[model samples]
Structure formats: C-alpha cells, structure tokens
Target chain A: MEEDENIKKLNPVEMKLLTHIIKNEWKTLIRGKWVIGYGLIFLILTDTLLRFGGGGAEVLLSLSNVMLLFIPLVGMIYGILYIYQSREFVELLLTQPINRKTLFWGLFCGISTPLMAAFVVGAMLPLGWHGILAQDPGASVMVLALGGMLTLIFVALGFVLGLAFYEDRIKGFGFTIVIWLFMAILYDGLILMAIFTFGDYPLERFVIAATMLNPIDLARIMVLLEFDISALMGYTGAVFRQFFGTNSGILTASGMLVLWLAVPAWIGLRVFKKKDF
Target chain B: MNNYKPIQLHLFGGLILLLLAWTSVSEASASDTAADIVVSPDGPVVSIQEAVNMARPGDHIRVEAGVYVESNIMIDKKLTLEGIGYPEIDGNLEGHILIIAADSVTVSGFFLKNSGRSHVRDYAGIYIDKAKDVVIENNRLDNIFFGIYLSATERGVIRGNEIRSYERRESSSGNGIHLWNVKDPKILDNKVEGQRDGIYLEFAKGAEISGNRSNNNNRYGLHFMFSDDSVYRGNTFNKNGAGVAVMYSKNVDMIDNIFENNWGTSSYGLLLKDINDSRITGNRFYRNTVGIDSEGSNRVIVHRNDFELNGWAVNIKSSSRENQFTENNFIENSFDVRTDSPRNPNHFEGNYWSHYEGYDLNRDGIGDVPYRPVRLFSIIIQRQPESLILLRSMFITLLDTAERIMPVLTPATLIDEKPKMERIR
Candidate 1:
C-alpha cells in the first residue's frame, strides 16, 4: 500500500506529452534505418544457420548460441547510442514544462520495443519459412521468447549507462563495452575459475547459485531446459533437471528475467529524474 | 516275486525293456534316420520325461501343443526336444525348465517361463552343463532367472531366443545368456531385455556374439571378464543401467555395434578396463554418458567409430596408454576427449572432431594445424565434475581458446596431428 502511494502517476498533461514524445521517438528511430538494419542482421544470421546447419534441432541450437552472445551486446549498444544520439532533443525537452518520467519511459519504450520486435521477427521468419516451427514448435517459441527477454533487459541496462554518462561520451562507451564483456565473458570465466579453485567442495548448490547470478547463464540454462535430453547432459545434466523441474524452472527463470528488466529501467528512470541536463 | 510289486518296479522294468528294444532298432537304422518319440497330450506316453525314458540316444522327442508344468526336465541322451506348436513349459517356479546334461543335444521351438529363483542355485530356462555341439534356438523365455546358462560348453550355438524378465533388482536377476568356461559359443540374433546382464561371459574364450538387441537391463547389456579373443559385432545395447563392460579381456574385436542412451553417474557405452590389444571399429556410440571409458587399457585400436552426441566421446583415465584413435568421426559430443592426466600417452590421429576449427591449407584433406581434442575446461571438469553445469559458457569458451593457442594444463601430446577435414564414414 505504501509502495502504491510512492509510485507517482502522471497527470493528464504529462500523459499527453509522454505519448507525443513516444510517437516522435518511434518515428525518428524507425526512419533512421538502424532498427531495420538490426533486424536484417538477424535475418541473415538465421537464414545462413538454417541453410547450412544439419538438422532441425541442430539449427535451433546454433541459433540460440548465437542469440545468447549477440542479443545483449546489440540491445545495450542500441539503447546507449540512441540515448546519447538524441542529446540535443532531450535537453531541449528538459527546458519545456515536462515531467522527467514522461520523457524517460517514452524513450525506453521507443528504443526497446522495436529492437525486440526486430530480433523476434528476424529470427522467426527463417524458421517458419523453413518449416522448422512444425518440427519443434515449443523450442522455437522458447528461443524467440528468451531472445526478446534478453533484448528488453539489456536495453534497460543500456539506458541506465546512457543517462549516467551522457556528459562524458568516452567513459560512457568504455563502460558500456566493459559491462557487455563482463556479462558475456568475464562472469562465466569467474564462475569456472571458482569451480576449479574450490574443486574439493560440494559445488552443486554453489554452481546453481552461480548460474542464477548471471542473466546470460540463466538464459542459456533456460534454453538448455528445452533441449534437456538425459543422455547428452549425463549425470550433471540430471542434477540440473531435478533442480529446474520443467515448468517451475521456466517460471523461476522468467520471473528472474522480469526482475532484471524492472530494476534496471527503474534505476535508469531515477537517474533521468534527478540528472541536471 | 513280485507279480504285484510297487508301481516303481513296474515302471523301471518297462523302461529297461523299452530301451533295450529301442537301442537295437536304432543301431539297425542308425545312419539313415534317428527314431521319433512323440509325446502328445493324450498319448500312451504323455509326459516328455516318459518319452525321453523310452527313447534311444539319437531320437527326436517331439512335444505336441500343450502346457507342461513339470520342472527339472533332464535330457541325458543325445537327442532333440522339438516343440510342435510352441508348447508352454512352466517350471512352476520350482527349478530349471530344461537341463541338457548330454552332448550333441538340441532344444528348440518352445515357450519357457517361470523358473525358480534361488539364492544358492541359478535357476534358468535352459541349463546346459559340460555339453558339446549343443544348439538351443528359437525359444521364448519369460520371467526367468537366467535365460540360457551355458557352462563348460564347447561349440554351442544359442540363436534366435527372445528372453524377457521382469526383475528390477540386479541381485535377483541373472544374465540372459551366461557363458562361463565356454569355447566358440556363438550367441546369435537373440533379444534379451530387463535382466542383470544381457550377455555375460566369464572365462569364455573365442566366443562369437553377434546380431543381438539387448536393452533396458538392470545392469550391463554385455558384461564380460577375462574373455579373450571374442568378437562382438552387429549388436544393439541401449538404455542399460551401466551399458557394456569388457574387463581383463584381450584381442577383443567389437565391430558394427550400437551402444546408445546409457546415462548414469559412472556409466559408459563400453568400459575397457585392464584389457589389452582390442579393436573397436565401426561401432557407433550415440548419446551415452561416456562413449568409451578406458582404464588400464593398452594397445587398443579405435578406428572409424562414430561417436555422436555423447557426454564425453572418450574419457581416458591416467592408467590407460598406447591406445590409437584414428579415422573416427566425433560429432557434436559435449566433450571429445577428457583425461585425468596431463601427460597423455594415447594417440589421437586423423579423426574428424566437430570442435576442430583449424583451416585446411594447401588443398589437402587434412588440416594444416593440429587439433587438440582436450580443452582446458574439460580438464577442469575432470577435477571438478560439478563444473559441467558451466558447459557451453562463453567464459569457458574463451579459456579453451586461449589454452588451445598456448598448450597449458591440457595435454599437448593428445593432439590429433592429422585431423580430417570431413567426417569419416
């Protein structure tokens, strides 16, 4: 109840200005060709994968692997770059009688929604055209959903970075790439290192906890659930299966992903609200 | 003295008289034809025991279509027990259904079931002891402790038997086809399921096991120890509890076999332990926990085998040495090779590994750069098994890449120097 009062709802004027800003942002971003270009990249990736990858299951695996590595980087870079590129427009809006919440959410939605659509549609077209959806509709839908979640989560992350370092472009770009590298590479490396270093301990619970810490690993494990053949996973895979528990596992992962999305966008909005343009 | 003696005396006297006449008649018609002893449900001699008691050495005892509830049906003469219409032989859970104690015996075309389970004795559907030139074929065995137990048998052929059991525990069940101290026992075209071991060989030499489907057993599909010069080919062992294990065996030729889907904490498609001079060729190990776990195994040649989607294609323990893996296609396995030791003495050459990303220059079929199958992360997994949860992690990929460029932690000698550009058929 206290939290409900803490959330400030927009007045009618703020809502009108918010919708206007969202419409204009969408127009500029769509007309800029970056969104369509980002989409075409996924089209080419999925098309090549479907053409050369051997079986139906194999193509889906390849697509997920590529998606896991590429989606976050693309999403974050797009979000940060868009925020920094429209600096003049954002500052000019700051001069008007506008609420910060209106501008922040409008920009966030405008940047994230199209990129999510681009990734999903780009990947889905090749698979549907090749009739891979008929072979394994469940796994295909899962890959697209995971891809969409990653895009939204990373875009929110990118917004926080953009708003935090708008004045300093070099630091902003540097920190953005560093964050991507940490999530994509260093986080997993540290997990492996910890596993090897503490080899003598009972590490099952530790490993699962570690996997939950990283969004990428969490996403990958979710994909692993879809292709959870008992043989390929061996004994270790069995432990993962027991813990994941199919439906509950997906629920927990999706919940975590939602949390990941909400926290970052909330922080980015907070930064936008107080930052002096 | 006994014009009205006990029925035992009457039966004994009648059997002696019949055997004397039958032996004399069989000697006269010896080479041309063996005599026929028909045991029908409504005949003068209805029981198979009564017919065998009245027959000569080389007679054919034809059992007509009926259920026989007798146990310990002993065949002590060199004769044939042929079932006319797959007559049921129920042991009533008492003892062995058929005990062939004589040489040159043939038992075929029967449905044998419900042998007695004892902690002391191995009650089987058909028990052959010290027999030579015996053939037990075309029989269906169900709910048996042991399906076909052959001990000290020479030149026996056990073929086309469908053996199924329902015992879930290994201690209560016996092997489907047990060969102990046997020579040249050709096990052919049998389907054995849900037993301790599908085909077990202990001290069985020069045995030929082929064309069998053994799946979902309590323990191993094929478990052999100290069996030398045996050939296992054209067999499918799937989803067994521990898969196949060949221990302390030499000159083992395993060709064209499919070992699939056996996943457990310490299971493998084939576990070669303390064996020497074996050839694993043209065998497909698919989706097993470990395709071939070699420990103390030496001088084995693994050629042209397809290891597909297994957890580990080949896991070589520190004690295994001098094994050659060549021309094999390692496709999409979670880990191509894992070794406990960093100093690998076994050779991996000319194999096509899906993980090999080296380029083939000079238009040759082989890659210019040698491909190392063991990654640093696999070594980490060897030490820490729980780290396998981090499989396909990007961090592990980077570590593997850096470790591949500079030989560190992983065995440098474990390189496939002449890696094939394409998969070997």
Candidate 2:
C-alpha cells in the first residue's frame, strides 16, 4: 500500500511543474510584445513576398526546413533566458517548500510555452499557405511536423544554453551563434573541401557519420530527399542516398535528431537542479 | 546415478526436438523462397531486388510509391525496374539500391537510395564495375553513396539523371556520377549536386562531359584528375567547392562553359594545376573568386572567353608558363591578374579590361595605350587582406590610377598591351 501510494504521487511533481510552466508561458507571450510583433511581421512580409516570387511555395517549403533546427535552437535559448532572468521568482517558489526538481521542470514548461505558441503559429502559416497554393495535405503535414520537431528541439536547446551560462547571457548567445554558423555553413564547407581533395579514396561511411551530428543538415536532407530523390541526385546526393537511402539511414538520422533534442533537455534539467540560482 | 538419469532423459528429448525442428525449418525456408515472392502496388515485394529476383530479363517490374527497406541489390541481368509512383527503394537503413556487377543493365524511374558507400568498395546505385554497355537514365538518385558509378566500364550513356547529396562531410562522401578508369563514355544533361563533385573523372579518357548543371556541391562541379583527351562543353559549374579543378590532365578542351559565382576565399572558376596542352576557349567566367586560376599549367591557349566581375580575372602562379589569354573580356573585377612569380608566366594580349582608358590612334581595334592589369591596391590587399575595407575609397582609387600611369609599385611585367575597349561579343 505504501509502495502504491509512492507510485501514485511520483508523477504529481512532474504534473505540478508542467502546469506551472504552462501558466508562465501564457504570461510571457502576453508580455513579449516585441518578439511577437517583430518576428511575425518579418515572417509574414518575407513569406508573402516569397509567395509571389515564382517557385516561392517550394522555396518556402525548403526554407521551412529550418523549422526543425531553428525552432529548437531559438526556443531553448529563450526558455533558459526566461528562467535565468526570473531568478527572484524561482527563489520565491523555492521558499514555498516545492521540490527543486519540480521548480526547474515548472520553469522548463513556462519558458517553452511561448515557443510552443510561436511554433503553432509558424507551422500554420506554411500549412495554410501550402493548402492555398498546392492543395497538398501531405506536404503541409510534413512541413508542420518538421516545424514542430524543430521547435521542440530548439526549445530544449535554449534550456541547455540558459542553464549552461546562467550567469552570462552574452557568452551563451555567442556560443549559440558559433554553433549555428558551424552547423549552417562552416561544417558544410569543410565537408565539401574534404570530399573534393580526397576523391580517389572511398569515404562514404565517414560522411554519413558526420551528417548524423548536425540536426539542421539531418532534417533538411531527410525532408528534401524523402520528397524528391531528385533534390539530392547530385554528387553529394550520392552520399546522402548511400546513407539515408534505407530505413536504417532514416532511422539513424531520426534517432540522432531525437538525441539532439533529449540530451540537451536532460543536461539543462541536471544543471537547473544543481545551480544556486 | 540419480543425476545422470534426469540428464539422459533431457538430452534424449532435446535431440529428438532438434531433428524435428531442422527438417521443419528447411521445408519452411524452401516454401518461403517460392511463396515469398509478391507483386502488388502497396503490398508488393518488400524490396526491389527481391522483386528483381522474381523477375526475368525483359520483365517490367512496377513498384509502388513507398519506402522499401533493402540493401546490396545485385542485378545480374537485363531488366526494366520501373516505379509506378516513385516507390522509394530504401537500403533498409543501410542498403544499396541496385549494384549491377553485370553488363547490359537498364535502371529507370525509381528513387534509388543507399548505394554501398565504402572507402573500400565502390558502391553505386547502378554500379557497373568492369561491366559494359549500361544505360542508366531518368532515375532520381537520392542520398546515394554514388549516383551512378562506372569503373573500368565502357560505352555507357548516363543521361537525364539527377544525382545529389546533402551530407557535405569531406573525406567520406561520393560523387554524383563517378567514372573512374573508364574510356569513351558520354555523360550528358545531368543535374548533380551535394556531392564531392558533380561529375568526376579519374583516368577517364575520350569522354564528353557536356550539358550538365552542377551547383552547390561540396567540390568542383566537374572534376577530372589525370583524365586526358576529354571534352567538357556547355556545363554550368556554380557555387561549388573550388569550382572545377582539372589537374595532371592533357589534351583537354573546356569550351562554352559558365564557371561563375564560385566565391570562396580559396575557390576558383577553373583551377588547372600541372595541366599540359589544354585548350580553354570560349569559356565564360563571371563573379568567381579567381577565373581561370592556372598553376603549373603550360601550353594552354585561352581565347574568346569572358572573365567578368570575378575577384581575380586571371590567377596564374609562377609555375605556369607559355599560356595565352587572348580576346578575353575582363570587366569590373577587383584584380585583372594575380601571381606570386616576379616574371610573367603567361602572355595577355588583345583582352578587354573595363579599366582600360586608351585611344586607338591607328584606328586598329586594339587600344594604343598599354593597359597595366594589376592594381597596386590589389597587391596591398593580397599582402594584407584586411586593407580590402579601403576599397572604392578616394585613396585607393587615386593609388590605383597612379599605379596604372607609371607601372611602379605594381608588377610592370604583368601588363596587357593592345587591350580591347569592348567585349569581344
């Protein structure tokens, strides 16, 4: 009976934390006038202009490839920042006799609330627009799920970054930028250089392993290659085909992206639990 | 005695069961081989190669639109593998679509993935290793180790194929369409990207690499090393890794190609290293890091080409000699020429430079005043790249003008006399 009672109460801590986060998320969105106003305006203007730009819909779909990457990245940063900045609130909650783990989990949910809202809004645009343009439900869902996964990943990332540099926002932001650049440009550049200079020797296995490390590259290639094999039917396309052409490659990539989401969140939670702030 | 009795009974029962199971398993496997073969739109064979096994030569195997988990599909004979609605031939997480080790094979209209990518084994979607007369066309190769690999194979036509890769890690990736140690092949009108190179040739001789758009690739759009007597015409190589590098190759002609917008600090439109007796004529280079970058290249005739708005119109290192740049248009570029060697490795004659301000007094097409192509500011920037921020300033403009007037503080030997005032077109 005692064991049963403990089991029943085990999830209460998680529930309470989750509820607190959800409530805080609403508050942040209501107060986050600048982020909402600016970000929406920029997205709308760019999206509308792109719609008229011929092959804009496809390009939009392609650009939405970042949804999986940036959403997780940005959301993670924003969530961690919110929790880090609200140290006084966290301390007040700690004084209320709530468990430290519960408080951190609550903070996690609260920060993620804004990111979730933004994600839904961001995803809807692509879906609605794609529906209007191409009447493609499959494409729309793919795009939306892509966006959703991205948001979760980034929100988790934000948490990790925030927790990692709780005392230094500048350092955290700088590190994020460096990571973004590495994933976006530098990594690809380096990869190309290697492939070109070492064409004689076979190196496909290494390329596949390298691709598993970057979430953005993984999502972009997965979506693109899944939709149209022709999209990557090039030099590097061959490498992609070799790795992701099978259920195994897809599974591995998906597994890696999932890890990218889970590991960061886990780390952030660990940090949030131990940190004085 | 008591322990032995229980053990003997257990062993006797186990032996009998094992014999029974072995016979049943063999029968089941034998039956499965015959009944496991399926053909349908949705509940079709789990793999294309499995479908291939059920198919005879000249059989039209129609595959549906879904993901099939398979790998190392060996097509040993001639067949038509067609996807009804682009059924994905997945290499079962890590598999190759159709590795054709035999000749006279034709693969078309299916999404081929996972072509046996090994640093050791040359895996390809339609790999013709030492096979001949293969026709691979109209197939979309995605994320393959190699789109269509032909090694030591001859008389194959790879046309209307789109091979691409997004995994841009250097040392361990494959090319779009790789032809190694092959001779007399025709590769035409393929759009390949995201690979090491779009169309790569290693020791591939007497082949025509024409009418292909290879862009956004990790390496060169078209790369040929030690591949000689080949013709690359009407190819567009844009935004690739180092553009197109043809090294240790001879008697090659690169004509009517657009090598442009390949702007990396160390990239070039066309990099010819240690190439001998090559003809680069009627080629257009626009907005590349260095158009026609030649190092240790000799006896090359470059004429009637447009080198417009590149970072450096012509980059000839000291090792290059007796190469000619004639009737080429150099317009609105930062540097007309760049070289480490003190002496002129190549001659520049009758080329149009946008900065050329000279009169044709004799009414000849060539300008009367000699045009010094190298600017002193460019030299300064070469030595100290940070000084590029001073570009287009009054000081830089004045310094360049002075350098052009006197030829001092600039490489005097790097002058293009008889500079045409207009484009050769």
Query: Which one is best on DockQ?
Result: 1
lDDT of 2: 0.71
- If scored against the real structure, what TM-score would every candidate get? 0.80, 0.54
Output the worst ten-in-a-row residue range by lDDT, candidate 1 chain B.
Answer: B26-35
Candidate 1 displacement at residue B125 in angstroms: 1.8
Query: Candidate 1: TM of chain A?
Result: 0.91
Summarize candidate 1's per-residue lDDT along A1-277 as a digit string, tens digits: 5345338687898788878877887788789887889889888988887775545666777788888998999888888898888889889988987767788888888779889999999999999999998887998999999999999999999899988888888898889899889988888878777877887777777888787877888898787666534332465545565775457667777778888898998899878887888
Pairs in clash, predicted candidate 1: none
What is the clash count of model 2? 46
Q: Individual DockQ of the candidates?
A: 0.32, 0.01
**What is the RMSD, in Å, between candidate 2 and the native fold over all Cα?**
21.9
- CA shift at A87, candidate 1, in angstroms? 9.4
- lDDT by residue for model 2 (B335-407), tens: 6787875578679899987667687887777898888887887676555442332333334555688778877
Please, what are the lDDT tens digits per residue for candidate 1 over residues B97-117? Answer: 899999999989999999999
For residue B152, what is the lDDT in candidate 1?
94
Off by over 4 Å in 1: A1-40, A46-62, A79-145, A156-176, A196-200, A222-277, B1-67, B82-86
- For model 2, the stretches where C-alpha displacement exceeds 4 angstroms are A1-277, B1-39, B42-47, B54-66, B114-122
